[model samples]
Target: MIKRILLLITLILQFSFLHAGIVILNGLTHSYTVENGKVYKGKIAIENTGSQPQSIKLFLQDFSYTADGTTHYTALHSHKRSNGDWIKFNTNLVTLKGREKTEVFYEIAIPDHVKDPGSYWSVVIVEPVEDIKPSDNKPGVNITSVIRYAIQIITNYDTEKAKPDLKFESVKVEKEDGKRTARIAIANNGNLYCKPTASLEVYNRTTGAKVGTFSSLTMGLLPSTSKTFYIDISKVPPAQYKATIIATDEDENAFALNVELEVKND
Candidate 1:
């Protein structure tokens, strides 16, 4: 009963976050292909879902993440490849009435001195100034939940000259929730961003027969960042096997790692 109650609370919190009073209508990622010494214009659309008025503050920040699920946010221009200095917004704060929709305009001015063909990025954060609290007055404790959204702004210059370099760091298998999973850690070592997909091919050691082939979900990897790919291997039969793990990006850049796998199914 306690576990079920906790799960209910978790679901409610997730729903609240997804259905926030202030929402960004333009999606989370805004990507652009730009040239040096050029100016690009864009806008972010926002809408107030609740009936009451909502005040929102918009700001820029640098964001970084790793394969271990650790994330860091710092001041604008903190990252080496951040484009924070190039972006300018028309406004930083706004108040919206009930069901009011608005748009925020911004521009990116690429400097003439930029000669490198690479990808630069930054994040625009939109947060509500008001805190949402539970409405029940008889509650012993009132929980306040504050929600914010970070929209990634990416600028790619000279895509023909940019290259993708993916590094396969490690691979391992683990059992959890009555299933087997193969996890692979991959890093983006090049100047561009990549969406990498991982695959595992297993072969029986004794018979030399192909056991199975499994693939993982493709995920985006930014420059100097890493992500873990998880492939379900629960259907593979228990046996001693030889396996080849391959990580491939959209550009067909592939990295392979060979390993011996033992599936006890215990």
Candidate 2:
């Protein structure tokens, strides 16, 4: 009788650990539009839709851009004339009670030299760094939850110039037992033919930091054509994680998207 009771308790513990109380509420934007080579105003809304209050930390990294066929990211107190610049609007820490939400706002400016304008992209990520005590007992522990929202801006240099459009279809991320993998279908939506180069960024969910980058082979994608790529993540550490996939055309215009995943080792 004691042996059966132990087995049942173990099963219940396992099930409780597998299903925790982490929730990601919807994100809101104050404004998302581009004009005169500048993103006028932008805001982010984060909510604690779980059963308990959450202590959260927020960080805003500088914007990145490609210039003269070269890619670069903005640095603190340093501005690149050729690439682009990131303007700091605001950053803060807040405690969100259950079913409550908070807002953050910022502004960005684009240089006039960026003539080949079509679409530019960046990401705003929010993560929960505090560990929550489990309501039930389990042998194992996993505590990292992150949510990210991608920001897109469309720019036009000339009325006659071709307008750029791009899309990703059937994007998916999977983690089973302990292995992780990602797959996506990229498509070109512009009238002009383009050869695209893809860059993938992997991040650690706990620390909200970048882990590594994976670059795919350059492929010639004609208008309205799509291609698929797969990334292997078996060697990555077991944690909550995410990836950003960036595609740049020959003219140096850029488009980006973000995906989230989990790694379980039970």
Candidate 3:
């Protein structure tokens, strides 16, 4: 004789959008440059694209990511820069009909006595509460998956005092399947968050003549956090070269590094 057990899996999806079912109509991120003791307001437009109605539950969670590609959603105020306590949502639960859309509102009240003028942030999670039934009557186990969305709310206080200090931690160049790439890791050692773009310039080691230049997409970097940037170098001919990589934010803050590379087709 044998026994059977059933299992259910729940996963919280991060980022701006989902493919089907509940969709975010407006956007996923709300960024604000705020002043002390001021109240700011915003809204998230959510829609049920599925034919069936959906019940959504909203709440706040602290957000953080690491260089190793680990993301965390912990209790409110879990981080030093978490502004969870400063936010108030209009409602926690909402019901939507098929093809129906609605707006969820919230307000952020900046504290007057906030001493540190940097970045404070949190996330509003919109989760669909669904009662799923097993598709087949099996003797084994069954699984059900639930998807959710995270809306990032970022507030920057005192831009002057919230400047980002970034540094390069590591760089590596690799060749695979006849393609070459450079991976660079960057860390923010400042008190604020910054969106930075990275560019790579290659020069001939023997002649110092510029060979090629490439840039990466912009990504948000938070204080005490780090991210990896990848640049394609497959077009560059196999040869010894010198490269300079620069990372610059929207505010014109730039950091650069120089390295030597020896490339080979094999």
Predicted model with the maximum TM-score: 3
Ranking by TM-score: 3, 1, 2
In order, what lDDT does every prediction score?
0.88, 0.56, 0.85
Per-model TM-score, in order, reads 0.85, 0.41, 0.87
- How far is 101's C-alpha from truth in model 3 (Å)? 0.9
- Which of candidates 1 and 3 is the stronger one according to TM-score? 3
Model 1 residue 248 lDDT? 86
- Which structure among the candidates has the greatest lDDT? 1
Per-candidate clashes, comma-separated: 0, 0, 0
Instruction: Please list the Cα RMSD from the true structure of every candidate, rounded to 1 decimal place.
Output: 3.9, 15.3, 6.4
Lowest lDDT block of 10, candidate 1: 130-139
Taking all chains together, the TM-score of candidate 3 against the true structure is 0.87
Pairs in steric clash, model 1: none
lDDT of 2 by residue, 1-266 (tens): 99999999999977754443334344322222344556565566676666566676655433433211233334433422111244444775667777777776667775555555344333344556566555676667665545444332222333246544667665555666655665556777664445577767879867879988766566544344476655656666777788788887776878888877565654
Ranking by lDDT: 1, 3, 2
Positional deviation of residue 131's Cα in model 2 after best superposition, in angstroms: 4.3
lDDT of 3 by residue, 116-206 (tens): 9899999999999876665657587665466799988999999786789889888777877766887788899998889998889999998
lDDT digits (tens) for residues 73-127 of candidate 1: 8997677899999999999998998789999999999999888888999999999
